[model samples]
Target chain A: MAQRIDVKDLDIYYGDFLAVEGVTMTIEPRSVTAFIGPSGCGKSTFLRTLNRMHEVIPGTRVEGSVEMEGVDLYGPGVDPVAVRRQIGMVFQRPNPFPTMSIEENVLAGVKLVNKRISKSDAADLVESSLRGSNLWEEVKDRLDKPGAGLSGGQQQRLCIARAIAIKPQVLLMDEPCSALDPISTLAIEDLIAELKQDYTIVIVTHNMQQAARVSDRTAFFNIAGTGKPGKLIEMDDTSTMFSSPTEKATEDYISGRFG
Target chain B: MSTTAPPTGKARSRSASGRAGDRGMNRIFRLVSTWSGALILATLAAVAIFLVLEAWPAISLGGEELGEQISWFPEDTSIITFVGPLIFGTLLAAFLALILATPLAVGVALFISHYAPRRLAQALGYLVDLLAAIPSVVYGLWGILAFAPIVYPVWNGIAETLGWFPLFEGPAADPPRVMATVAVVLAVMILPIITAVCREVFLQTPKLHEEAALALGATRWELVKTAVLPFARSGIISGAMLGLGRALGETMAVLMILSPGFLYSFAIFQAGQQQTIAANIAAQQPEAPPLGVSALIATGLALFVITMAVNMAARAVVARRKDFSGAN
Candidate 1:
């Protein structure tokens, strides 16, 4: 089930230095929202704070709130671990556990949380998740093979299957196709379009054309200078953001004049 | 375009030097490196030959040239009888040390690599590494004078209560100088080594994989179990085997803590019953006659073989899961 996310006045900091400041947005359920920005613009940093994955790095602190379905994710006594169970993530690179088989990699989210499943249920879940990622036919015969034996695109799909196996309400992808070939990138883009039908999706991409192609809502982030904190320049429907109304900086960035 | 002759001339001269009788610095570098690698193999082969040659007399004579049983030498017994108990004691003490130290070392390693605060972790790592720098003789003295007395009462209590177990059988040594004491000392001796290797491997685990586990709602312990431990399994095995090798060859600590005897007894709590090969060689070699010295050399050869076999076994274990190896 997809869930709406409300982020209010969130300031992300690494120690005393604020990396992202004064950001506010509401992400709609069952839709694709993309964050497009240049290097060091803090779009990825903001995405990490949504699931509190940024806290994994020492000295990182978040001010303000990220609420999902009316529950404050960072509320007192709320465990980050539990927050993550409801929100999954796919990284810039595919990272299936090298020690696990294809079937086990698909079942990693459920198995790693120490849940018990019957043999038949495990088999069913593996099949459904792999088919959901469009990887079932390619790997069904080799379920016992190591996940690392897959090609780059297949490995990335395997990671997606792993993330969704736990049935999270939201999925955050940070440049999921950045490391793939053009053909693999198209496969992932198509999969992303299909995934939005069932899960609220947030993606950060360096490719402007990618944001225009797949996202329903587009948010542009920008920085003033090398050492300045990043800020959200504008947020609008993808067509309007690309075609007409936007801040001057967003227009220049979209036109490829400068980052 | 202007022609630049200096760059081309320099290359020609370099190739010319290679073809000339001088053979150039590149050839010299290759020769030096090749010889360095060859020297290591040459030295190992030489040592093996020496051990086999020196141990021949003991092997050929058997019990024909037996003399009175020296307290430490047991020269009166046949070579088989003398060395059999020594092999058992060596394996028992080293493996006991491995069982005692491996988990503790791995925990300390994980704490330093993943659990400790960033600033404190560096200092903690340095302290653990410092433990390895201490001399084996110092550990021997510590085991004998300080630690043994402290644990003597516990040893006696275990023997009094759980003496039915073969390992704890009998009246515990009053001074607590026994194989168990030797094992404890050896465990401490090897702890730093295993911790250092394991910590290095744990630190080198891919950050991407760790984040993947965390994003799946895995707790810190769960992340370590799923991501860190499996990746470091081979490295842990290698580290433990390295520690076992040290424990097996450790002479000074075993000699000081284990009162020397040549009996095959499984009762590790008792004194004057068990003796390891290295310690036996160290204790009895000085007083032995020619044939007795050969017997001691044979035991040393056995120790060498056991260590090699252990290293081979470790490699096999590491290679068994080739498809799942993190090296990919």
Candidate 2:
């Protein structure tokens, strides 16, 4: 079984400005958890902190504990590089290495870091990873083509495949469907559903319908006022959150009454 | 329902005049742009034609036999001895400078773009720009007085330590005027241009591409290798070509650093043995014999051709790898 991610009293800051404050959440293993909020509510910020991806930004800091399977990821001796290998991320934009071929991009995580895989094993890994992301049938024939030459949706799936090639226990996606067309969104949604069976998945999305449709659990986050920190308002099973949200802000946000 | 339409007799004529005025202004802007573009092309063509005309006399008087004759003057008032060595020197020095400058330029660019703090990078970039602006003659004087002496001891140390190698086995002499010294001066002269171009290319590496690599567990160095370097490779090559072009045409620095001989030798440290095309023309053009003048022009034409070929090759490489930006 995959390990769960535990976030305790997580606060995110960009320079001097606090972005997200007092966010506490436990992401279950083998479940699809969706983060839905208005723009600038720090849903992506919170998600980035889960895997220490936020630290990549200059002057961005996190104050809290993020643990994976009982190991504190932000401990002094821990390496962020190793943390990222255990928990992968897909950006809002699908950015496969433009210079690498499709097959190369798929196996880059393994080959660039490890450099010990045999040619036959690499080929199998590429095929299996693409197949796991539901992109093998579409791109198998053109494995040697540049990853940049793929369509937007296909490229996103290729990125997902690249992420999964390393076999990360958790996947963090920041608005993965926002850049895609409707058809591509459906393909990614389907892939996400399948992915949750094997790994823990946390996605931040502006699309409430997507959150309701695909997520096993949903966390609604919102900012209170100008210059205020974004906070998690409610989190529960997807159906319950939509049907009878425990908080009025969650109900108001889901029904389009107010943000 | 009954309705009444208002007349716009005065407003219609006024608006029509305004439209005509606007069109006239647009026409003037377009004409200016077109004329400027044509003038640039015409200037390039005029320069090319002038160089060819100046070189015609040497081209008509062949140098194939004169090369072997070893005489200073042609048997029939032709002069070719000076040119062969000059051309050889120019190309050799340029090649040497490129070899020395490329890696250093790349390092400087990478440091400025990826490693240095924002203000420090900008300050260093300004310093490089200042180096580029320093006059060529100033560099020549500096090479003769300061650089040559400072660098000679190092060259001597290398020759002593690695004298068994064919290149390092040259005799030590005063002032250290040699092809290798000339090449070093040329490298310093062109370093700024290469670093600036490479910095620009490195800066243009897509942020998302870098972030993608970083998000996927790549360290800073790994991100540079996977995302930044590959994207900037072609751009760096193009920048190096630009530097090479500058190095090939640089006259004063090479003239000061090299002993200026008409004989060609592979030993870079050998004084009184190397000459470059630009230095040759500068050395002899004032009181040159008629054929000697033409031959120097011919060498210039040859240098021009080489520079053009390098530029074209750089363009081709850049075109094939359009995604790579060579900005530092």
Candidate 3:
């Protein structure tokens, strides 16, 4: 089941360098929330901290809290691995395990956890997940082929299938369509709209139009200057944020006047 | 150097030109590199020809010729039969060493490349490389003096506990200058070679793939299994093959550590029970008559063929898996 995420004064750091300053937001369950910002603005950094994926980099630290279903994800006893199991992530580039077949790539989340699934069960999950990502039709006939052989769009879709196969409560996508062509980007946007019905979705995008089209809520992040930590500027309903933002900076950013 | 070149205007006007000097240097480089590559094949062919020509007498020797005592060719057998025990010993010793070293080498490699802290990893990598730099003669000395005594009790324990197994069936060597000790020494000798290559490959695993595995809720070991190991599989095979090549042809360590013998027994802990082809050739060459030298060369040729076959097999394995590794 999808769960609401409540962030309370969260700060992110890479060693001694603070990357994202104190900020707060509540992400609703079963809704599309978009994070929009220019490069190095810490929108992606903040997104990574949600599932604790940023901790993969050495010396990265998180302060304050990210809570889901009233449980603090950054609580002392929480395992990052377990946190990740509940919150799946997709990266800017599609990475379907190069050594695996299309079907096996879709099953990577479960298989990597060492779960035992019957042949029929594995087939069903692969089929359903691929269909969910809208990749089943193009790939079903060649499920045994290597995943790396696919086009960029198909590979990204395959990665989406992999993430959803684990059935996480929330999904974080870091520029999922940034590397795709416009047609492929539209397909992913449609998939996002459908995915939000069952899973809480958080996306980071450079394309403002993408956020406007797919997201129910939009959060804009901005950096004050070089070497300054990025801060959350504003967040509001998609229509309201696009049309009449309370902050001058948010309006400037949306209107292409400044970042 | 600049003064020797053509005028700048002429040099620049030539459509395909970089610098006149560079074009000339490139031509020389191509010529030298081509010759260097050709030299390798020429030397290999020369070695093969020399072996066959010198080994001709031993190849043609019959039982009657052996009785004539033209030269000692294993007393009663021809060169083909004489090489049987040597071939067996070479394969067994190298096989045992590979078994002993590959997992340990891969473990140490994984630790250096992934598990160790940054500074410690660099230090450990250098330490392993330093081991490879130690000469085979020094390893031979260490094998007989330090390493052999250290493993003597363990060898005896194996003979006592697992003596029912053919490989362990032994009244262990008195001074322990045996095939089993020699195999251990060879394993240590080859460990750094495999570790160096494996560490390089493991370090080269794509960051994207590793992050994918990590984001999938994979543990450290699981990530290694799913991402790092698969990508490094071909590299590991090639590394192991290189180590095996060294073990197979290693003469100094085997000669100094193993007491030369002419038996086909699998009992490796017994002294004077086995001898590798290279070691046998080295050991018998000095004492043998002229024909005996020919017989040794024949065995050397055998070693060469075996090493070549092993390398070819490794290449085939690597090539077969190339499609799925995304290395293409």
lDDT for each of the candidates?
0.91, 0.85, 0.91
| Two-chain DockQ for each candidate model | 0.49, 0.34, 0.44
Query: Of models 2 and 3, which has the larger TM-score?
Result: 3
**Candidate 1 docking class:** acceptable
True contacts kept of 2: 0.48
lDDT per residue as tens, model 2, B95-204: 89999999999999999999998999999999998998988878888888888888888888777788778767766555789877888888888899999999999999
Best by DockQ: 1
Worst 10 residues of 2 chain A by lDDT: A106-115
Native-to-model Cα distance after best TM-score fit, residue A208 in candidate 2, in Å: 0.9
Q: What is the TM-score of chain B alone in each candidate?
A: 0.90, 0.83, 0.90
Ranking of all predicted structures according to DockQ, beginning with the best and ending with the worst: 1, 3, 2
lDDT for model 2 comes to: 0.85
Clashes of each: 0, 11, 0
Off by over 4 Å in 2: B1-29, B62-82, B160-166, B322-328
